[model samples]
Structures are given as structure tokens and as C-alpha cells.
Target: MPSLVAPLMSAGCLAGAPQPSLPVEGGLLLRPWRLADAAAVVRVFQDPDIQRWHLKRADTEAEAREWITRWQQGWQDEVAAHWTVVDADSDAVLGRVSLQSIILMGGQAEISYWTAPWARGAGVCSRAVTAVAGWALSEAGFHRLELGHSVVNPASCRVAVKAGFTQEGIRHNALLHTDGWHDMHLHACVR
Candidate 1:
């Protein structure tokens, strides 16, 4: 019988990857999510702005804990890297940022983020995203990082721009929110 192992090995299908580490950006620290963050996650998701954009709601502590667990699993699976955006000085949870849909073989990933209500209007998301993008491009050796947001969310668009992501174009009817399908503005940054 012909061996399949030779083909797989030649294709680089068995390459090992490294785990991601927490990144610090001045006042903000991008650290792994913990069960202790459940309360903060619940509170942040309860905000109307977060609910309107993200669609997924975590109203209870249990659901928030589950969300944290999923992030942990994503790390183990090498599919995503999620960070709880926290204030370095106070260690207070300010929001979250993630490098999702990570394809190490392709050297690309997508970024997503949300800021706590109290943390909004202060460029928290923008700074956090910029730091993560720098890490992804330089340390992680990723060539491209993408971000998209509902066109209706101008705030997110501004964040993307401030973080150095170039606006690419619109994806028509890309996201399905509670209201309905909405167009999304695609953005990207290249190393």
C-alpha cells in the first residue's frame, strides 16, 4: 500500500505552534481571561451597545464563565487568542480583545474587541488593538490582520483606523444581528 504519512509530512501538516502570551500596552494589559472576570464580562455584555453589535448576550455569571472557558479552549486548540483588556495599574477589567480565526499556516488572523461602558470614549479599544496587531505582526510572524464591523458602527470604524488598519471595502449583508442583516466595513493591516 502507498504511504499517506509521507504526503502529510511533506505538506507541513504536523508543524507545532507556540502558545500566545499576555501583552502589555502602557496602561492596558492584554491578559488571559479568568473565571474571576465573569462578573465584569456579564456587566459589559449587558450594555445595550455591546448587545446591539455582538448579538451574543451573557446575562448570567454561568454564561460568562462559559465564555471564559471557550477562550481557554481556543488557546489549547490554537485557533484563537483572547485577552481580557485590563487596567495595568488597577487591574480592573476594562474590556476584551481577541485575535480570532487564526490560521498560523497562512500567517493571518482577524481582530475583534469591545470596551466596557465606563471605558468607552477614551480610545481604549484603539490602543489595545494597536498593541495586539504589533505583537501579531512582529512576534507572531503574521503577515496580515483583518477587522470588520457593521457599517452602522462608526465608532468601531474609527477604532480600526486609529489602530492603523486600512479600510478595504464593504461586505454587503455580511453580519446578521437581531435587527437583521447589516453591511460590514472590512479593514486590514499588513506586516
Candidate 2:
């Protein structure tokens, strides 16, 4: 397999660490999701909230491995970047974030994030979101970042705002929710 560390730093997502991890506040660290994290990542998907807002089905260990493999490929292609949030003190997987669909015309990309059930409401997602967004703007050369949340997911909307994303507007039937198609609240942050 290709070295994941080199591509992440080359993508402008890290600096000077000679490693994949990005240190954040409150004893937390963010690094690229690896195949080894498949099982834990699948566990995060088991959270109903994660499935609901993320609009994805549950993942088996095999599927998680494949997913991480694809994430690595995306980094190689310069198409997207992914990170696994972990506790710096314990190295426990807490969640994930990806800066995807980067567009230079708009100089923007979409941010997707989720927290393990156990980590909710403790400011983990907020800090990770802010850290990644800051890196994207300051180092990754992105001019704006966007996020969309199902109208019913107030928690995600809260995270977006807490991370400095401004509520832009709502899109009718912008996303398919667990129940059915639903409107999405659009948010954006610009440099």
C-alpha cells in the first residue's frame, strides 16, 4: 500500500509532524482513517444519529475496510481528505471528518463529520470541525467551506455554527433523510 502520511502532508493538510496525526485541543488528535480503524468506524455507524444525518447504511468490518481503502485512494487522487478523530491521551477513535468535493472555482469544499455515540455533547465535534476548517483555510488554500444538515438535525446545525459556518439558506428536498426526502439547511464559511 502507498504511504498515507506523505499524501496527507502533500495535500497541505499537515505540517512538520512527519506523521498523519493533527493535534487538536482538549487532548484530541485527528488523523486519516486507516483500515485498522474499520471495526471502530463501523461501531460509530451503529449510532442512530450517525446513520440518520449521514444518510448511510450500517457498515460491516469488511465494508469499513473497503471504505478506508477508498479514502486512501481519494487522498492519492487529490479528490478528498479524510480524518479520524481520536483521543490524544488514549488514541481511541472518536469520529471522522472529510473535506470533500473541493472546487477551486468556488475555492470551496464540503465538510462532513460524525461523532461516536459516547463522545457526543462534549465539544469533540465542534473542536474537530473548527480545527479542520481552520487548516483548510489557512494551509489547504480553500477560500470557503460548506455544510448541509437535514432540517431535523439541530445538533449538526449547531456544530456547523459553532465551527463558524454561517447559515446560508434552506434547499427544498436537498437531501434524503432516513424517513424520506427532506429539506437541508445550507451553511457556509468564507475566508
Candidate 3:
């Protein structure tokens, strides 16, 4: 029998990816999460609106620290990437974005993001999404990037569209939020 592992290992996939800070338009940058960001992470996850959609809450600084550590682990494992959206000039934490469930062999990944409550309605998430997705496609060599949100989340749908993802369809009862099972609107962008 042939060695299946050989082919996969030789694919030059994201086996040991490096996390790099990427600059975006409008004086914003996407950088790796830091331990010092625990306070902001806790604050963002504490918001009822964010918790409602995310279905998880980081109530304490310890929990927030764990969240950042998990992203660091993801980078070490080369399975995902997480970035903290910050103002380039002021260095203020504006939001968070991630390319999760990454499968480098398949050249695919899922994108997710949440904007700080104070940053919402200012197009921060949309701009961050565009920058991250473009980087994942062009720089990272991902062939397809996908994102989905509860169908009730028109704001997220708008952000996905604005970031160049095309709506594929709705998946029934695809995600369970705090409210209950939600139908998710799937969107994707292909390179």
C-alpha cells in the first residue's frame, strides 16, 4: 500500500505558520492577540450583544487570558489564526477577527469577527474582514474562505457582503446561540 501521510506532509501546507501583523486601510491594523489584551477581551465578551451571537462569555480576566492563549496555541499548531483589530495610530483595541477551522490541505478556512460595541456602526468589522480575508487568500494561499452568521443577524450579513463574500444559502438550525437554534446564512469568497 502507498503511504498516504507522505503526500499530505509534502504538500507544504501551513504546518508551522507564523502570525504576522497586517495593516489595513483607515489607520487600522490586525495583530496577534496579546496577554495584556485580556481586559479588552473580557470587556468585549461581556457585552450582551456579543455574547448573544457568540454563545460564549469571558466574564473574568482569567477567562480572557485563556482565550488569547488558545489563539496562540492555534498559531503554534498551524490550525487557525486570530487577530485583534486595533487603531494603527492610537493602538486602541477595536475588535477581533479570526480565520478558524482552517484546513491547509484543502486550502479553506472559516472567518469570524466581532466588533467592539463602541466600534460598531463605524464599519470597523467590515474593513477588518476585508483585510483579513484578502490576506488569507493572497498572502496565505487559501483558495476558499467562508463565513456564516445567524440569519437574524442582518448586520453581519451586510458585513460579509461588504467584505466580498457571496451569500450561498441558509443552513437550517446550523448554530445554537443563547437564544436557541439559529438558521445560519452561509457566505463564501473564492480565490
The positional error of residue 187 in candidate 1, measured at the CA in angstroms, is 0.1
Per lDDT, what order, best first? 3, 1, 2
Error of 1 at 85 (Å): 0.7
Where does the lowest 10-residue lDDT sum fall in candidate 2?
7-16
Consecutive 10-residue window with the lowest summed lDDT within model 3: 3-12
Q: After superposition, how far is residue 23 of candidate 2 from its true place, in Å?
A: 1.4
lDDT of each residue in 1-191, candidate 3, tens digit only: 76444332223355444688999888899999999999998888878889889867899999989989999888777678899999999889999999999876667889999999989998999999999999888877888999999999999999999999999999999988877899999999999
lDDT of 2 by residue, 1-191 (tens): 66433322234343323325678899999988878898898898887777777756556999889889988776666667789999998889988888888654445789989889999989999899999999888866788889988888889999999999999999999777668999989999888
CA lDDT of 129 in candidate 2?
A: 93
Candidate with best lDDT = 3
- Among residues 3 or more apart in sequence or in different chains, the pairs in candidate 3 whose N, CA or C atoms overlap within 3 Å are none
Most accurate candidate by TM-score: 3
Q: Indicate whether candidate 2 or candidate 3 has the larger lDDT.
A: 3
- TM-score for candidate 2, please give it: 0.87
TM, every model? 0.89, 0.87, 0.93
lDDT of 2 at 156: 91
Per-residue lDDT for 1-191 in model 1, tens only?
A: 87543321122221255344455656778888889999999989889999999878998999999999998788777678888889988889998889899776667789999999999998889999998899888776778999999999999999999999999999999999999999999999999
